[model samples]
Target chain A: METAISGAILAIVTTQKDKVASGVPVFFAKDQEEVQRTCILLSRVLKAMTHDLENGVYILVRH
Target chain B: MDKTIQIIILGIIVGTAARIYMLRTDYRQYPSYPHGIVVHVSLGVLAAALASLAIPALMEKEYTAITFLSLAAQQFREIRNMERETLSKLEELSLVPRGLDYIEGIAKVFEARNYLVMFTSLVTTSVALWLGLLAGIIAGITTILISMYLMRGRFVRDIATVKPGKLHFENSLLMVDDIVIMNVGLEDQREKILKDGIGVVVHPKNDNGRAILNNLGQRQAILHDVSILVGNKLEVGEPDLTPLMRKDVDTGKLALFVVPNEKDLECVIEAIYRTPILESAAYYPLKSTIGKSAAD
Candidate 1:
């Protein structure tokens, strides 16, 4: 049985960029509303699922 | 007509009838009309021809023709591979692909149906040659009925109970009753899910049922079938409405969440109940002594 991660975080959209590390592409938003818009746009562009980290950070993952 | 010719034609007709009876272009929309039907019927005729020839060849002391049955078996095996390949290739582009377990079950069914056709013809021809045409027709009808009964596999309803579950959001986490499905990052998406989503809980009746539900492939099959039947809101670049199933760690109950085109809770529950229990995912651990002892 081969085991590997089925999904990967393609992009991160966050209001607090200080909390997120920089490996994958990251988008910074000014507020909660901006964060939602940016997350939706990034998810659409990346064609990935937007998952809430629930701490002002959203990660786009392709599953 | 000559007796052998009569027998061959009778077997071919009976076997093809059996195949046609088993072939359903139902909600699954499989063995797609016209072309797929034509392919399968042609194969059924070929299998019936091979099987119907067997008894007559033996009656005439022509033993060499018996080897051809093995050749036909090889042909049927190739058909299984052909089906698997076709379905697997088609799966790549599907929004909700039927998992490998479901595909294997379908392919196996295709192969087995061919064998059932052969058996029906063989029995029909043998009984007709030994007894009479009337006896042969009776035997053919009986064999077809038996084959149909035997081919019917257990569905999810046999092992589990399905009921509508409450869909709610605990912050960003989507919950179907007590089970947490996944996190929705977008506020609008969460609102859409709240407005349109349907939640269902599948409670297994026994340890065997629990084990089968535990299979990821089986869970996926349930999702795929439910999506196909009820129609899902899932689309390209929109994973927000993607249907998901999550299990309770404490209990074996599965919680399914789907944003269906039609938000009829009862229809979704019915779709869940009707999903065929995949053959590969079937588990009978309770049949073992150790498992039985541990269950208590």
Candidate 2:
């Protein structure tokens, strides 16, 4: 009986479960180029590590 | 006493009943009703039935007007179902409230268009059918063939667009607050939807993250909109937000290598592994359900 009253519209709005923000600032870097360079270097290192891990070889061996 | 009169009246009654049944069923399955298609279809069938009765008499042949309207109504049902599937998906993504719908009584937008298109095709075919039995059969066959194409082909987008005051998902409409968002784009359509359905903490529009979508060459467009969730593995320390790796050299000094973006799609998977859920029960973006090539 009460189901119709709390359909999709009600459900999305009435999130009884609140999402607590960890307040872990997703953004930290103030400089743009530094952030980009950081992200790029991090990405490259991750890529090489992953390749070594998948191929069962060390980066030095691959090099 | 006249055959045309009898046929026309019979068509009206039968077609109307079928439509009512179809609409009732749609209401049962979908969260919202397909108002536009139902209204257009119901009226269209009634009009066609009356027209078929008169037009055939004037032209001196049997018309499939009633049958066509009835069939078209069924197809409208299919269209509404597809529309609802999209809604259910968005609903899952949006995490609607528990007790009151922020969106209620809003009908799907394209239903009417879809219904009218089918009805018009039906009427066109019925006219052809009325020309003769052969004409009717040929028209009916052709219509059926086309409906099959429309049913399977990715001919239209089912995504919602932003309106002045409301959001218009393909068939279903919604009130502003029916979905989740971390931000709301003001004064424009670009990056508007990114802020809705589900949004991550870091705006993909990070002053530094440059993303571009190349439509295989016809055009290139910026696509900073990430379907990332709040707590998903995000590389915190940068150059690339990738996890760190270190090596020991001959002098026992520590060295490190960073991940690259292109190869980082691999890192993306790793990042995916490292990423935690944004919220305890947060919903993921549903836009991923649709196939990509279909959009192209």
Candidate 3:
């Protein structure tokens, strides 16, 4: 499911709560701070491969 | 053996050569290596052959041959669509993508170039058939030169001034000159931008230049070209480091912030100047009657 949070400032894509499936590959953040925070949390805690897009950031998770 | 056949042969050779000379892989790099070159060259040969044959067929009162020319025109329109599709797909892969307006401008140019080749061949063939071989040679050279002149559209330097500017921060925000680029919340990334980044202010010469610079596509084109030329410092996870262009709301001056691999300020300025004016974004406000009266 795709959810736009913070008045379209951040977009999150996830198949289930606390479990990001492989198919959901993109995430959007409002600015640098949000992107960095999201990427760090996803990478370190969730063990996902995150990349930055110009406007937002995306993550790749296996199942 | 016939004079008509010999003249047509000469036209095809000259016209094909002109087309080949003009097909260069430069900054934009639309028609890439091997397959792309082959496709364009083959189409060029077909166009030249059809155009050269048109004169003799008409001279002999074979009016049906004119229909073939119309068919070729229709084919070239498909070429434009092909180019647009190819570039749009490739744009997805680019680190800094060429915007839709730039892509459309490039596609249109490819279509127009093919038509030019056809016209050059027709003119050369007509001259040879009516005048002589010497006249045909002269006409061929003249047409090539004329095509070359027509192909060179305006560049950014023709209408704007690019000069280096200092990058500073106002609290947490990154500012290039007086224009604010973005808010940098992290101290580390802010330092990185300050250490490696370069800034330039583009001052439009007139209303036309202002209008062109204001186009989002044109500004993006400039950022892309500059990044390609000097090389971008952005990594996959660093959204903060993406090159950005912002216009001063009051003055209409565009400020560009780039973190390039090569730090030479002059080279960055030169690259910005050499960036081609996107045909789709080109505005000629000064040429219009209303604009002229307003200026007066």
Candidate 4:
């Protein structure tokens, strides 16, 4: 059975970090499916709130 | 009687001490917290020099043996404490996921600046010899002060101090200080998700209570997340994703990552570009955004 997508919360870098630096994390996830689903939801919410968020690189491969 | 020999010896003592101070600051390990060393050490050295100048008779009692050794021991204790504090800071840096790049770049810059700071002290020795002990100490102290100021301003330490805020969450509605909506998305699209590819299709709904009737002659408008009802599944060998390999310390193959299509990704983005209309109640009012920024 496919992993049921679930919503979760995660914080991301609100500003630019150095080339090798990762932004300070303010969010967490319960599981992989939850995190993925939350990420998808977040993409929409951010686009609705701010359009710059939509300009991110999305990587997906056909199964 | 000329004091040329005494002046030479005094200059050597002062110059060597100053040089050593500059070197200590130059190579001082980072994340030096509880940091009272810079001001304290400079003050101590200057005080010692001033005392020697005020009463040159004290220098004749062979005070170098016990005094210098004790001073060295105290300085050693401070350095050890500093090293331990630095080790703790380094440990904290490792725990944080991001900012590794920023930290590394900052460390390199500090190393460079340290060299420049130490180089300035060499020039001070010549001035101290030609001028006097007081003049030499003043010039050395000035240089150290300037370098310290610059380092504090430019050095990369930690993220701009974070303050704790009251966070609240609800079902479907999350509020993070003043009603803010969260958003997320990926950059992949596909007809069928073998791994994690997105599927986009047009879902045209039929009007009220019409199960048999089709909506707008098959499909009138395209919408995101409408692929569940569309797209045919693979009949034969279970649809699989392309495999990927990565280098590891030991021999091991990496898990495959699915690539999303550009079209589907854009479609979802377009859908999100449409600001979220406040979904209240059916009988109540639905707050529709008349093409305005989401913040408003």
Candidate 5:
């Protein structure tokens, strides 16, 4: 499987296969731009909330 | 009254007094309230009495009386377990929980204090029995002062320089003195943090200080102490408002970001300095031969 997650990058998505398999809901992005764009988009679609972990991860959790 | 009996009585009184002086409910509110104080003092008196009797009993060639000291040791171990369990349970209710490392350190201190009381009494009684009343009183006072001094532990300010840092946002990232704390996507939250947040940068003086600061448990303890003193500005569900401590990997400096109810930076810094260095998290690299050579 070509995993979308790459070394310490932050991202936002509807769901991730690796996260599902591991039973931990997290997403990764290649850079800050991708993280911000994906998070803004996902917040609208999922009607959830987006939070930055400040390290390099963005969390989209149900409010 | 016999000299042995007088010496034993004096020893117990001095030892119990020393133990009572050491018992306090400071920032870490263990041995809580009237009931807790009563329990500990009672135990302390019992330990002092047992230890004081040992010297006189041995002087009279009563060898079996030494077994009571071993029994007292067993009782003190149980006290340690009680403290650890109670603190662990109370931790669940804490807003900023003291980590397990801190809890263990506190429990160990409590247990060791009882043994210190016993030892103080034993020494006092021995001195009086061998020499005289005046010598015993002098020895007792000196021992109590020494025990009090030994109980005083090092604080964060002993090894680090804490200075107030300016909080600023650089392209959606919150920075405290060039150290990135977190990224804020919400404009409203960012505004709040900017208005109310206080930042402190702790620069470690030596390799030992750096190692201690690197422990996550120690960092969490600092955050907890600071929050408890100044009051945390976070609500139950607001994870975004959580205080953070981030370390610069290169220079070993740690930056703290907190939104306190009181925006007094000086008070926050004072509280940080007063935070007790947890025993388990203490790292003394300077004590080693290799580290000594490196420093030189």
Candidate 6:
């Protein structure tokens, strides 16, 4: 009976803002360092995994 | 004392002894420490008492005593439920949870052990009542040995061969040999993985072994076992370091990627080999005619 959301993108951290435009919250990082920091913080706070799209976009998803 | 009393006492002693002999706090660390052992041993005593009294009761023309056997069966079933509940509840707090399949297997073993105790008591008591004390002692020892033999289930090495695998990164993706484990987003994490991560490949000997490796629960069991022995780098919210098993699509071979604290490849390989083949994950496709032909 217990259920929780999984495999859903909770947030997006991207170096290129124009590349990721979705319903989820998006964090635009000015540089590679900021992008990595943002994604790691988001993943820890959200208790999710950070997966790289390998196209300037990193996604946080609970799985 | 009466001859029946002598027989009943012998049965209880042998049965309890057998139960105690079977109970051991191994690497699994199951049944907890002192309290868990106390609970199971007390239940074993009760099961033994019930079984040992049966023959004597039957000899006394107590027909109603037969119903107690049925009641004992119900009680043992409750023990299985209790074990499953306790383990499932604790699974939430475990760093590497033993999956449902492994839990069920353990629960079933707990239940079966009680039955084995009962059987040992019954046989020993009956033999004593019919033959003599010396014969009964011999029979009790024999049954205990037999129970020990029966309880020794197959390990992973019996079905598959485990060997070290090469860990490398293909851009953002982590690969154990050719099998893709997962993608790490952070540069720091990927570098840590490349340096600390140990990979092991499991090759199934036959179609049956391949089918078992395909089961997610079985894969989880391998990860859990290896992590326990080698120590896992995973922490809360740190899924990047979690041990994972991924299989090649074309072949049934599995590759495990684990960021262990020890970084010992030998221990990891040994742990994987020692993992018990879960009963739920075992598939006998080779036993069927259709599957036999399809395997080719």
RMSD of 3: 6.7
TM-score of chain A of 4: 0.35
For model 4, how does the per-residue alpha-carbon lDDT over B1-296 read when each residue is reduced to its tens digit?
A: 23434443453354335434543432223333334445434534433443233223233455553354345445445544544444446645331111223233333433333333333333344345557656756765666566555644311011011111212223322222333222213212121332333322211121110110122111111111112112222221222211111111121111112223332445332432231111110111113343223313
**Considering just chain B, what TM-score does every model have?**
0.98, 0.28, 0.97, 0.30, 0.93, 0.98
RMSD in Å for model 4: 24.9
Candidate 6, superposed: residue stretches over 4 Å from native: A1-4
RMSD of each: 2.3, 20.9, 6.7, 24.9, 6.5, 1.4
Give the winner by DockQ: 4 or 5: 5
Mind giving the per-residue lDDT tens digits that candidate 1 earns over B1-296? Answer: 89889988899899999888888787888978698899999999999999999989999999999999999999999989999999999898899999999999999999999999999999999999999878998999999998788878899999999988999999989999999999888899999999999999999999999999999999999999899989999987898899999999999899999999989988888888898898899999999999899787
The local distance difference test score of model 5 is 0.81
Best by DockQ: 6
- Candidate 3, position B201, lDDT: 94
**What would the TM-scores of all predictions be?**
0.97, 0.26, 0.84, 0.27, 0.82, 0.97
Q: Which segments of candidate 4 are over 4 A away from where they belong?
A: A1-63, B1-93, B154-165, B172-174, B179-296
lDDT per residue, candidate 5, B78-182, as tens digits?
998988998899887676777888888888988998998998898889888888878887888898888878878899999899998989999678899999997
Interface RMSD of 2: 19.5
List candidate 1 segments past 4 Å from native.
A1-6
lDDT of 3 by residue, B1-296 (tens): 98998999998988898789889888766576789999999999998999999999999999999999999999999999999998898887676778898888889988998899899999999999889977997898799899889889999999999988989988766888999987654456778889999999999988888999999999988988998899998754455678999999988899999999978899899989998899889988899999878655
Instruction: Compose the digit string of candidate 3's lDDT tens values, residues A1-63.
Output: 223132122334322344333344455555556666665565444423333232333443311
Please identify model 5 stretches exceeding 4 Å from their true place: A1-58, A61-63, B292-296
The 0-to-1 C-alpha lDDT of every candidate, in the order given, reads 0.91, 0.30, 0.80, 0.31, 0.81, 0.91
Residues B9-116 of candidate 6: C-alpha lDDT, one tens digit per residue: 999999999889889878888875799999999999998899999988998999899789899999999999999999999998887889999999999999999999
Cα lDDT, model 5, residue B148: 76
Candidate 2 lDDT over residue span B196-294, tens digit each: 322111111211111110111100000100112121222322111222222122211111122222322333223222222111122223334443332
Q: What DockQ class does candidate 1 belong to?
A: medium
